[model samples]
Target: MNFIPFLIICPLTFLAGLVDSIAGGGGLISLPAFLLAGLPPHNALATNKLSSSIGTTASTVRYCKHGYFDKRLTVPSILCALIGSTCGAHLVLLTSDTVVKKLMLVVLPVVAVCVLTDKKEATQVAAFSHRKRMLIVCISAFLIGIYDGFYGPGTGTFLLLALTRLAHMDVRTASGNVKLINLSSNVAALFTFLFSGQVLFAPGLAGAAFCLAGHYIGSGMVMKNGTKIVRPIIIIVLILLFIKVISGN
Candidate 1:
């Protein structure tokens, strides 16, 4: 609503985009930036979606250009994510925030330990057949999309983990597919928020520019550095998520 708020929000949003493009959990930073800048919770969430969806689209394109996307899994994953997000968004209106936040608190420590202990190379080949992998990816997309639409702190990060571990994808391909899945879920959630007239276009669009710049640069880093860059960021994001949940924010 004012220049002062953008001053605070834009830079953090850029950082959010950067971290998000590389490892997911951008919302852990960006949403709080909005809240810190004095937007109401609903407006912050809606506007953050607008800015992030734009930024994510840029990174998704970059990943596609780098030939990291898996063509066979894209359509089914996107479809399931869309449906799941729609359901989650609706479900949120009926649910209590306390319930979800408490659930995340329980889940975060185990996730942190797993990520910390994982020592496998990022280039490992999948053990699952194509059909099985597709099934795993789609189911994960749908479930994570529901989370994204409802609570939405670490959707991208969760998707990345699921892709890498459960689907047995290489990190680069999993990262690329995670972007596609996140973008779809973001758009689905954005439209729901838009319909409710909650988005703040001025700040959202302003934030989008910074988000785009950050995401573009971060995606390049991912393309060049791959796992070396991805793992640490995921760890940082998980820590941030832990803090956010513990604080009940």
Candidate 2:
């Protein structure tokens, strides 16, 4: 196997990690790169998760150290995400993914539009009761975590949006919560790939080291600028994912 391609992939993983840590949708960059690198689909996915989990773990730690994480909320979401990601992984083995791809094609652009049109200024328009919000978050995390395990792109953005819109967290808090859940989902997927022995370790580790740099930069940026930075990055990532999904067709 040619190792030269990885020289480029590592930096891209770094950039994607930075962008993903702040907003979401790192796979928009990494996944296509993997596919182009000539790995089989399953191996590409399994390898991506191996690298991605490390990047996300780094980001999660950064966010935690910055005191942005809410353990009460994060703990529950992490538990739910673990369950959701495992279910999603198993479900993919039994189901056709064509429909999910089609749905994502439609839904991603719509989500992009909403982000584009959203008004400036953070608002807590979240009107759910505490009990209701917890329930919604649990369900949302579970579903989205499954989606992450199966299809894998845009999971962070989905979690952030759900928390901001449904659970009434502001963008900053939503990001923190999203990171917690994402960490769990990535860990769950990593376990699956580990068991299958599909991960490409050499490239994955090289990619992960670079990705850690990006994660550090992204974590600091999010902590400093709050959602002002997050919203635009998320919009960009969503549009990229939309383009990627369409291009794959």
Candidate 3:
């Protein structure tokens, strides 16, 4: 119940939620904040999941309320994400962090270029058959869900990109779908940490309040501005991820 950790975590969590709500990669900020505040690594990761899960729920509801989510893809995507994330979590136990970090170093730049070079407008949906799109979406969701569970720095950004570029969804709809998928993964992880007693509820709850505020505002901005807001934030998140990987932090 230290005020110091609360002070450090809450503000950054707000910032993290804001960035995450818009373009993903909030953990690049929030997780580090928890560590900086002196939480042990396990507790920091656990508490981060707690706060982020709550904040993500708010964003997901907001996106769905705005009719940005695709009902047809919802159940399948969530199921795939759940299964993938569970597998990913287990995979992490067998994998080395160094391997993941090295892979990200190569992957992040390519992702950034794709986001930058993407000329598609927020409202422009790509042409793809419904069945084909469903296949693409579900597969992407499952694969990215595993990445979320295994490495998890920019899962939302990756999902957003996949939905937009691969599944041919518009930015608004893709963003919403990303939120839903991320929420499932986050909640799954949160429960694991919660059951294991790694979550620090006092700070986690406090951070959640701030995170909720951030998500509300950020998602509102995306709803208003669409791709103009999202693209830049995504680039920024990519840059942050790249730095984190290279620096090995």
The C-alpha RMSD of each candidate to the native structure, in angstroms, is 4.3, 4.6, 4.5
Kindly list the per-residue Cα lDDT of model 3 for residues 1-249, writing each as its tens digit. 677778777887887778666655566667666665767556666787788788778778878999998889998999998888777766654555556456656755664555445454564576788899899999998998887665465677778778987888988888888889998988776766666687898888888898888877876773654445556655565565456546645
> What is the per-residue lDDT of model 1 for residues 1-249, given as tens digits with 9 covering 90 to 100?
768989977887887778666655566667767766767556776788888888778778878999898989999999999988877767765555566456556654555454444443575675789999999999999999997776576677678778988899988888889989999998998898888787899989988888777777876773654546545654555566566556655
Candidate 2: the clashing residue pairs are none
Question: How much lDDT does each candidate structure score?
Answer: 0.76, 0.71, 0.73
Give the Cα error of residue 145 in candidate 3, in Å.
0.6
Per-candidate TM-score against the hidden true structure: 0.78, 0.76, 0.75
Q: Tell me model 2's lDDT, rounded to 2 decimals.
A: 0.71
Model 3 worst lDDT window (10 residues): 111-120
Off by over 4 Å in 3: 21-24, 93-124, 217-249
- Pick the lDDT winner: 1
Per-residue alpha-carbon lDDT of candidate 2 for residues 1-249, written as tens digits (9 for 90 to 100): 487768656776776777666545666656545554555556666778888888777767767888775566777788999999988766654544456556656755555454444443465756667778778889899999998887676787678778887787777767778888998998898787778686888877877887778777876773654446555655554565566556773
Cα distance off (Å), candidate 2, residue 33: 1.8
Question: How do the candidates rank by lDDT, highest first?
Answer: 1, 3, 2
- The superposed Cα distance between candidate 1 and the true structure at residue 154, in angstroms, equals 1.9
Clashing pairs in 1: none
